[model samples]
Target: MKPKIELLAPGGDVQAIKAAIIAGADAVYCGLDTFNARNRAANISFDQLVGIIRLAHQYDCQIFLTLNIVILEQEFKTLFNLLNKLVNTTLDGVIVQDMGLLYVLHHYFPTLDIHASTQLTTHNAGQIPFLKKLGVSRVNLSRELNLREITALAKVGQEHDTLLEVFVHGSLCVAFSGLCYSTSASAGNSGNRGRCSQACREEYETTESGHNFPLNIKDNSAFFDLPALIEAGVYSFKVEGRIKGASYVHTVIDSFRKQIDGYVATGELTQDGERLYKVFNRDFTNAFLRGDLNQSMFIDNPRDNSNNHLVDKLKAEKGESISVVQIHSAQQQLQVDKQQITSSVDEKIAHLSIEKIKLSLSFASELDGPLRLTVVTEQSDSLLPGQAVKTDSQVFTSSSVMIPSEELSVDRQAIEKRFKSINNANYELVELDTQQLTDGLSIPFREITTLKNELLSYLNAGVAMIAHVQPPKLEHHPKADGPLGLSMLICDEADVALADMTDGDIYFKLPDAYKRGCTKYVDFLLQNPRLIPWFPPVLIGKDFEVALNILQQVKPKLIVTNNTGIAYHAEQLGIQWIAGPFLNTTNSYALLALKQGAACSGAFISNEINRQQIKQIARPKDFKLLYSIYHPILLMASRQCFFQQSVGCEKPRIDNGCMLSCDKSTSIKNLKGDSFAIDKQKAGYPSIYNQDQFLNTDIINDLSDKFDGFMIDLTNIGAGDRVSPDKVELITQFQALLDGQSEASAKLSRLVPESTLLQYQNGL
Candidate 1:
């Protein structure tokens, strides 16, 4: 038989975890109060996590902890402390996004399994070898991949002995995961840090038309593609929604469970797709999964919330008064018997409890010897978390007796019958081994019953001893040093010309949206021998191939990229690359890993990190680093076109062939009354920038010695709140600051009215 495909469900809290297991999920993924993607969810505390893990294992369901958020240098200690505590529990594995954390965990906890999170942006097969070398047992492919792309990557995974995981159902992000910075730039709450404000789900007005939600893509539902996914060798089908309530969790999991089982048994789905839609959805689209992007994936009626009747119908079908207990909240706990309404659904919840101990048994009865029975009880110790332990392997012997063959022959069948009669609701017989010595062996039936009772008592005692094992303390790591340097990222031809006039060995960054018309300037800039082309964060399919062809023809010495797909292409083309800011390089180890894995020449520190955390980064001698001082921080890069939506265009506007009918230099005002500049020139996708410009001239002097150089990104200066339209004046003003001119700060304030320090003083 083929290996069963795992149905992985989400557990937002303890109640959700229980609901998922009872609803028939093979595995559940959950998070604690910290270090996970869903920070807004009412996550379980560390104390509650231990109990949840034990409970999950008791139900024969695996629990994979979510440590999917990026980790700063200072947060390492807390992460280590949590992992140390988790060593005593039965956690199946961990899902990680940061390469540094993956490296540290794989090395320190060699026995634990590691899965690469979708935030890694693993869309291509070329990125698999590097992750496999980092000790990743499974890779969660990016949701942007189509069916053919996924199948290709799955084959690669099979060749490398690595597993592939895909998100079959979930809300889709307009920008690729880990590539978006909208929440961070707009609200100071980064998606990478698990505090996203969901800036995508907001309203904005276009220059030519009225207001609309152009960035809100519909939720993805791939129920129809289950057979193809399984056939392509996908090991796990992940359902995304850690912030949803228990009723939603139970409904979705149970529905999918039935579908998966039905597919496995009869090669057909037994559940209705409408039931899944009724559970909760913005709209449904399998665009990327089916390799069809031309379809309309956005809902015209975006905010109706029409699934309330479905929740009531499901509640009526269950026929039980189920009260979902909020054990962690003191106020909610006080009203345990009272029905509480949740945001996703309004259904009553009831609680039920059951416990069972899984064990293996062996029996030996010789002709002239004692009847020996051995019961091996499994235990989860800190040193052996998630691994089975035989706590009681020794044999218990009974008195031997001999009798005539005709008297009362205790045959193998008789002995087996007696053992099967031993019953207990809390005990599960996993395996049974028997030895027969039936010749001239006669024993009374009463003796067999007495032996079985004694064995149960012995097994119970061993279970208590194994449950009390404690975890061991872990050791700490010391900081180290590295090299640093400076680079400038520019958006247009004017900024490139200004960069040529600057002093020192500076590199010019070509915008990700550079078109064929811009090639004339490339030869002119190449005279300086320091131009690096930047690839967009969402490169895949034909776009990726086209970009690869262009890069090959240009044959630039170095490239800059954020997505793993581009990194793979760069490596294959024999070009050295640098990690972009969107890669979220927070700690020193991640820099080292990228340098080795992606052949990176240098890296830029993430804007989300604080000044103190930046200083704490241990620099390596060969690795170069760059820090940005001035730039219009990117709020979002969405596939949806605000201009097209505003103009009432019905067809999907994905490619550049679709005309941007709005004024090119226009800005959009959000609900918060803040205006963000929208640039639709980049492949028809809108790249939004914060209204306020980022200025950190005060700390340049202190960081000059530590970093190789500081950066001034004048990419979308005109779109910023206050800035002169003259390119030369802007570049000269930034140049004065880089040179440490005393009057530069005063000049900058006069040039730009409102600016933000942006995490330079405070961390996320």
Candidate 2:
């Protein structure tokens, strides 16, 4: 008989922890008071963590502590000291994401088990052996894998005799689990090591038409097949809800438990288990797991402000249960002929005629329907449970055979239709090489205008604004003249105060990065009355203090704080605040939720979003257009930069920070002391080296028409590195082109002029 799979639940708070245990969870994962994954959760203090561990152990349940957040050099001493104390406690395993942390846990707490967090983005089989060698007991596979992919991966784990864990239920991320820099790009909060602002939850507008869209919704509101993945033989099932209420966590975990049991016993997903999304799915999306769904998963529109009927259906089914059972035989194992099976309602008999093997089974049935039995054969004659089975038929050997379930059938048409009608928003203009700009790029202007008019023609169209793409440029110029026209300069107040001349009206920015520690500077600028302070997202703990002392001392025109942190201070001060794009106000709910802090929020649309989805968000709130186009999401590191040392990589220092240089670009990433070149491709695209960049030159003109400010995301630009001539040139030319000085702008107009220039323009 196979070992029973462990059911793990997230405990963001103490109540959530209790709920998980009550819901029949075998184990619960939580964070300590400081430097754990949930920065906002009222995490367990050191003493409380120890108490929780003891309490969990008393219940015969296991407790997995989270030391998963990214660590900095300064915090190493304290972190290791904390780890040393934890070693004496009943910590079953450490759920870890950072390689540096992994190294520490292994060296100091060598007896401690470690489970790789999903944040590690362990997507392929190659990582298994590597992790296994590092004393990792289990791996949480990337959430983006589909049933087939996950099952295939499970086979690898089985062959290697390692444990595999997967997200069986709860909130699903739109971006790749660990690869997303959306939070870091929008705000400086990093999610890789777990200080995230949940930026993906915000809404945005489409690129073609500036229609607003909301991202906040229930879990599984998009297109995930949780039931299918559970049946794929994952060793452990994980539920994501560390930030949610206890009821929500309990409801989600209990539901998945039933689903897993049902599939295991009956070889079928019970209706209640299959439809768990109806309980609390924001919008269901299998993400990359189900291949690719054509539509955005969460589709609540702010403009309409109507409750989702789909969500309502799910909510109605909340707390419904599903059940699964473990099957075993009192008699010996059964045998079966090729493609043959035998079973009774009360008992099951499996016979392998060729091997002359037979087995009998008896177990409690969890399904509401009839008891079903299945016998599958493998490639090799060794019939071991959890091992990959291949069909070694004399006729021809194949990979696997499935025991058919009477209750399940594949719906080809439903799957196809679901794919086709996913999301239908306007297309964003691809950044073109102005150098490659020809009649093709120019003609798109007419096409976009036509599209705008066509959308507005219908009263039911619900289109709000058209997202226009602005041309690219490198530097900010106050005065310029040409055929293009006047340009908008996105300059900081420092730039304005330091400039020799102030003839042109430049949009003054209060960069959340540089001016974060100074309130006096903000007060001085507000007194000048000449500054247009465009505030971005602000931090909560330290930066919050900076905003309070001097924010009310001066009356500023606008403030932006995404949905969290400093915006609260800005709003309480009665200043007109414009919400930042980091808030991700994709729909009405998001807008309403974020509106308490700022009067207006900026909405950005990705190429994957659709116009209808945009309309879903625009109808609710007053949004001031920020940058029409968003550059590549940038990774921001609050953790210490990995520039100078090899301390952790070699000896497993408590403080692990290292620099990584690729052929394309140089970057610093935090990892466990036992880190290696896991996968350069995943660390990020060679963005600085030209492998990936958000230089949307072709779409610039289109974005310029809809946004109040155009943007260039340079957060990833290394602090010590020299300024990028290409970026400066891109901004300079973009301003020139926006100002109608086409000749002045022409130099920086194109990116990769040789490839897809014409083809992309034609598609637009």
Candidate 3:
């Protein structure tokens, strides 16, 4: 069934919002001037946002606030306080891009609905069920999905009882959400944390081209691909023009409105939707939505004199043959033929002409032989009833074009292969969870065994990993499972590797940097052989030379870095590498783009993706699913962690570097008591640890199909949110979901059943 499509628009200021709403938008998303992810846009003030919310409500429209920026520890207090006040307002859920913000909001304002920001880079169906479990009521599917993929995701949402939102129209990013670090990489301001400088908007190409051509050359140009997606299946059609003028808002919204209404009536959108494109487009190509990034898509000079004629020629070619192919209405249908016409014999509908037939409620026609077109209209015309008609040959005479089989083959293979793997082995382990007592109290031994037994049962039930929120001590202690490591207990990064290291006794892994350069560590690893590195940091001293020195001496298995930095250094020293989370790769092209980027062994990516998207980003052989799922994906180089800067800022107070105001959260309730911001005063360091976007085992199963291993991150777990048993269960369930499934499999979350401890041992 066609969705009740909503035309969502961006509104940076009052004018744009008014223009978009007046132009027939169903919803609008924008931000506050201070903390919104799009800091540079003309964001409204808090007061203004409230007013806008009320006004939109009055208009029977919805307002999605943009708290889409990654937050710093200092900002939490302010953010919490602000949200505390806003929760009482008439606004709908805020569009949140940051996981830390999501956690805070979920803890304090669980009743508040959350629309996962596109910045989260949610690109797969497996991600939907987990998002629903995380209390995400609605999701803005990633901008990267093509039409067919979105249709499947919509099906997934319907299957899992989740609402899917998508971008109908918007500013298309060359990079995945929050992952485009060009600004942060060039300057010091990180886009993930809300201070992007739009470095991709610049244009420069290096004359000296090495083995790598385009990447070695700088290419900064705006790219747009909104229209085709809107015509597809994005339920909430978003327009990317918050920074644009009211004219832009009005024009774009009007064009989109027409297209959406057209789709509702006819099921097809006209080609070359140039309304917004004319306003401001970087010579649009369907971005990667076309399945390949063609060179023609890059618009080098908007003012190039030849562009107009070229565009005109393209438009002329596209519009050469407009034919009435088909019409569809309840209980009525008509067919058109080049030679003649056939009308449905309902006498009331028999009197429509070709033009009226084109606009009738039901009709069908063969166009160019292979193209079967169908259209539906709101009302039937009696003056000229639906009929079969033929167009003048002159209409299509000049529009003959050849279709490239090679290009079609490549696209078919890419999309088909990506979808084909979805049915591979998969399942999810669900664990009963309890809140963590920060004072480090352990759970009762009897309770621990009961949880362990439940995990073992699931493993026996063909579940690969046990997912639960038990402390590492309970999950891994020899006595917990009677000295046998049954199926692996899925765990976050803090514990997964750590458990392996301590003879399967510890769940949290320590930093491997201390272990890498030391001979003692190497000898110990050689002896133990079962140890694994968790949350390993790539130590870059001054530059790659120091890293090379360490690598030669240590001969560590993996070295990680950003693509550019890694490319520069790796080229100097020949070696395979791992793309770190810092790279922010969210699609296949980016993954392929980075294959030789640093000669990566595997790539690290943000957890904002589901299995299908991960498969696209990394081929089966090269992807590593590190830190499977963390709530609120954080983009920080450990070198830049606020804790490393100072010791005294741990006390919560208004200070620089903090983006949140905690005072406003006093009235807001938290599931885990009143959650407090990290105290920077006593610790001499900021208490706010980086928040991770929440992900679960089901999403991990999707990851397993695409990547080699998982990284269950619990860094924030111990520091502030601290890895809890629930988070650990999430990891365990992911493993159990994958262990023995023959097809894409999932264990519907059955609250961990009561069971007796069963011991089974496997030697490493």
Give each prediction's root-mean-square deviation over alpha carbons. Answer: 12.0, 27.5, 27.3
Which residues of candidate 2, in runs, are more than 4 Å off? 185-187, 205-211, 214-218, 221-231, 271-280, 301-307, 310-764
Higher-TM-score candidate of 1 and 3: 1
Writing each residue's lDDT as its tens digit, candidate 2 over 30-52 gives: 99777677777766666566555
Best by TM-score: 1
Clashes within 3 Å, all models in order: 13, 111, 96
Candidate 1 residue lDDT tens string, 408-453: 6666666668766443333567767765455566666677766776
Q: Higher lDDT: candidate 2 or 3?
A: 2
Residue 717, model 1: lDDT of 38
Instruction: Give the higher-lDDT candidate: 1 or 3.
Output: 1
Candidate 1, residue 659: lDDT = 27
Location of the lowest summed lDDT over 10 successive residues in candidate 2: 345-354
In model 1, how large is the Cα lDDT of residue 573?
78
TM for every model, in the order presented, reads: 0.74, 0.43, 0.43
